[model samples]
Target chain A: MSDDIGQKKGLTRRGFLKSAGGVAAVAGMAAGGVAVGARDGLAAAGSMPKKWDQGYDVVVIGTGFAGLAAAIEAKNAGASVVVIDKMPVHGGNSIINGGDFCAPGTRLQKAAGVQDSPDLMYKDMMKAGLYLNNPELARILADNAGGALEWCEDYVGAKFTRLNFHGGHSVKRANQTVNASGSELVNKMLAKAKGLGVEVKTRTKMERMIANKDGRVVGVEVKTGYRYPDEKTGKTAYIKAGKAVILTSGGFSNDITLRQIQDPRLTEKFGSTNQPGATGEALLAACMAGAMDVQMDWIQLGPWTSPDEKGFGHVPLFCERLVGYGPMIDPATGKRFFKETGNRKERADAIILIGHPVIIMGDSYAVPKQVFPRALEKGLENGAIKKFDSLEALAKNYNIPLEAFQKEISRWNSFVEKKKDDDFGCMIFPEARPTVTPPFYAARLWPKVHHTMGGLVIDKNAQVFGFNLKPLKGLYAAGEVTGGIHGAVRLGGVAMADCIVFGRIAGKNAAKETAWG
Target chain B: MTRKHGNIRFSPGWLFAAALAFGVLLVYIGTPYAAPKQVASAKAGDCAACHGQEKVFSPSHPDTKAMSYKDCLGCHAKGGPQMLQGKLPGSHLHQLRGVTCEKCHGKVAKPEAVEEKLCRTCHNAEKLVEKTAKVKPENPHTSPHYGTSLDCTLCHRQHAKSENYCNQCHKFNFVVP
Candidate 1:
């Protein structure tokens, strides 16, 4: 029986190659760099395995928010689905993310009495994205984000108990999870996907997207039992997708080589707020299979990260929370440099141009009210956030000019009282109090590479577009893997919204594809 | 006497077996401290079976040939500086407790990497979570991200030194044993 199966496999492989000869010749030249390049394509293009080791109706790569959502939706659509993650654990960066889902016109917004709509959210995204966003994709994200958030809270049994605000948005729209961590949503989604009978396989890395002769992605070549970051480990295997393959593998924020190739300024000097496995191999593998990429250089640096702490540490929570409630000061001159409530890009660029870290400070009143208790406690414990009994002490601690610092504090207090800023047009909330309160809390701010706003180009349906500007057959992409959604900048809480919104679309569409064999 | 001598003549199969045995003997002698052999009935302190004549302990150390895990615990008490939990490789403790190589790896000529299922046969994951529930900072056995599904070998390596896998992203500073 084994010999007969082996003979049949050999015959099929030969037949496949014979039919794919023309495409294989072209793909061979495209994949020539794989032999000499250190970080290039994993497999030669058009190199389908002799036999498929596994089969599923729809195969999903990545186990992040998008991947899990896609897997659950695909499984619910009555298609046999499998989700693969290279990491030993599921929930890529989604697990570690700050739990803020921005959706307009939600219950949280209504209760908070914050007027918001999908149109306003779209405007905020487009403005922050510098009008470079694809109108259709942005519209889809805005329109479906509310439904997706509802699905997360109602269908997946995740909780959003608080309303928050991000700098780019016009009003309070971010619905924060109860635990203040994305693990709440991602873990729930993971459970939901598993309960739906979708096979979730961790430590299985995708090596290549296997496309048929006519350029339809039929399956994926993967490494099973893979040890992450160890290329030599795991055995080569193939998983045939009878219908389609969804690429939800996240961005290349931690991929120094690839990020530098796209943006030379993003060198090793900048630390990334991403997991170690947030690399670009899977995205490049898709590219080798004919998917086109867009805006590959529009990488984002978070302005609120601290050099004192590691990877997206507690300082971000502190800084983001205190933005509208306090003032940001340049330690060198002891004065306000930029708008305290400016968007991430503006703030990060301002700090980068300053050539040193700046300070974001809030009084005791603002600190206790605005900052999350755990974040404030952890930040103080780690020495990333410092406490001062007086403004003079704080200024002395940061080596700021005491006189100029006092003058700036008074100026900021005046703006807060008037609820307006004439200098940088800083937004002051109605509840924001003057900085006259004792016991100030402050944190040093430095930029870190946070997100990449560029990846495979996909249409409104989350169908991956090839270099020919046509939808790639049997290939769908969503979340950070696909570009043109956020364009130049992704707003603070929009990633969760973007991932879920498009992920469901991709999953349902991928499952609806007719089986090729 | 002539018939007896003729009967003692060696066959080709016997000669081949003799040569093979001699080759194995040479290899054994040349590398005394080679990869451990699967000696199921060997005592825990019978280091000579695996280490040959290599000095596994200090010269002043007491003879451990007859000592069991409990006997060793008399000197290396829990929480003591010389505690064996983190010092010795986990396999040694298992061996001292009378768990032979065959118990986990099975009676195979060449033992490959075992999956977490083999460990689960002995150590229950949910029970371990309950046992370590009060560990400071966070429970090492379970987490919100992976829950209790992390591979046992990730933190409790048997052959090599153990590691705290959570320290990659978190500063839990867990003393993983």
Candidate 2:
């Protein structure tokens, strides 16, 4: 099936390399074409190494949710699998993630009496993604998410005890882990994978994909003993994958140089919520190996992060909970600018347009009721979340016009009382009360580069597509590394679902591939 | 290229210039301002052998030539204001504690990176976790992500300044020693 596409393209490996090199040279001379140029230039398949330092049936890049899930599934499928991470530690951004696994018809959802289905979840994803999502891939994610969640629970022994709501979702469907962090799942998955005899190595970075003369990916060139951010370290080595290689190296939100190349507005001025190792080199290396990328410019920024705290701090928990129960006030005008329940992109863009930090506040009633106690406490301890005894005090702290802020609070309270926002159509929850309670809590809001919604293009089966618009044989990808799942923006909790659902698929299919050797 | 000097055939000016250049080269090589040399067999207190007379201690500091780890603790006691717990690199601490370079790196002429298992030879992972269980904020020895399996070098860098790796994403103010 894969060979048919390659034959139809009618370009042999030699011809393809020549043409790609020519195109890269031209692209290199053009302004703002460095990524494309580098991709094509590096895409030239490497010469076969005389010896392989290590061999496995499946070699997975990254140790995040997707890579670990893929390793476990591939191992279970009877393949000798090896997972590698460039970082010294295992779990990538997955460990630091706020564990919100969005799946429809979940046990938690049912227990909470919130009706949901895969179809509803699919619609919400499409709506938030601006209809740019690959419908087939998105459908696969929606359909398989429930089973994946069940696997994570029943098979992997991870616990999900809470049902929560994220903005842009139809209902409360996020199945949050007991610890409220993705480490609950990732660490469990790591243990499970290791128990199944899967070899996991850290500080092993993939330098490039090595494809055979037939244009099939056969292995990867790597730097063993790698010290990250120090390219001078690590010894060059090769690892042959007898069957296939899966790329789940994740997004490039923290790569300031690469992010700015894609979107000039994403300068160093904007902080990122991702781990320091969330760079684009691995994804680019795949692109260099004939993989095609899409929607690289549709980077997602989190609207809830604070400049006061560092990467994905406790303030996000405080701010995300306060939305809809209170108002996000532009301190300059003391007015609500955008809808509190709007999607991530809309809220972030609105804040970016305002040119400075804004405020998201909830009174004592909303704060204590909506916010997680631990997050609230930590945020207060860190001084990211501040308390004010009265509206005047809140306004004084943020330098908001006291009289105008007082009037705005009254107007917002009226909206909450009526369960409607007449101004910006913010979704006012039914249980929300007036913001007249003393000792209101508020946090400053500034957008941080959160997720990159674009990456290597992949099919529904998790096979990566090449620049020739055909499956790149022996190469599979899932999670944030593969794009067209969440189009323009990724809804808050769907990333976990996407990684697990497709990661399993990639692993299984990668194991099933006929050994090229 | 031959200079026509029988026993002293070079021009007098050139001879003087050559002597001056050689003296300058010797001074440059002898000065401690260059990179510090690593002498695997040197004593922990013999700083001058590797440092080439570099002033590593303050002028008021007492001589530490014969001081062992216990002897140094008289003035630099644990938890004291002058404590060297976090101030000194882990390698120096290890040296002071009598774990010489050969203990982990072996007697190889060129020392390479040491694996975590070597660290486990002296510091039991489970015992360290138990020892630090009562640390404020959270225990640094074990975390939800890596548990007790995290590479010790990630936090306790031997040759370099140690850092709390958790502070990259979190605000854990651990004085990593």
lDDT of 1 by residue, A423-477 (tens): 9998898899999888999999988998899999998789999876789899999
- What lDDT does candidate 1 reach at residue A118? 94
Residue A102, candidate 1: alpha-carbon lDDT: 95
TM-score of model 1, chain A? 0.86
lDDT (C-alpha) at residue B23 in model 2: 35
Candidate 2 clashing pairs, residues 3+ apart or interchain: A43-A288, B5-B9
Q: Judged by lDDT against the true structure, how good is candidate 2?
A: 0.87
Candidate 1 residue spans exceeding 4 A from truth: A1-44, A324-336, A362-366, A387-425, A428-441, B1-40, B46-48, B52-63, B71-75
**Ten residues in a row with the worst lDDT in model 1 chain B?**
B19-28
Cα distance off (Å), candidate 2, residue A470: 1.4
TM-score of chain B of 2: 0.78
How many pairs collide in each candidate, listed in order? 0, 2
Evaluate residue B69 in candidate 1 and report its C-alpha lDDT on the 0 to 100 scale: 89
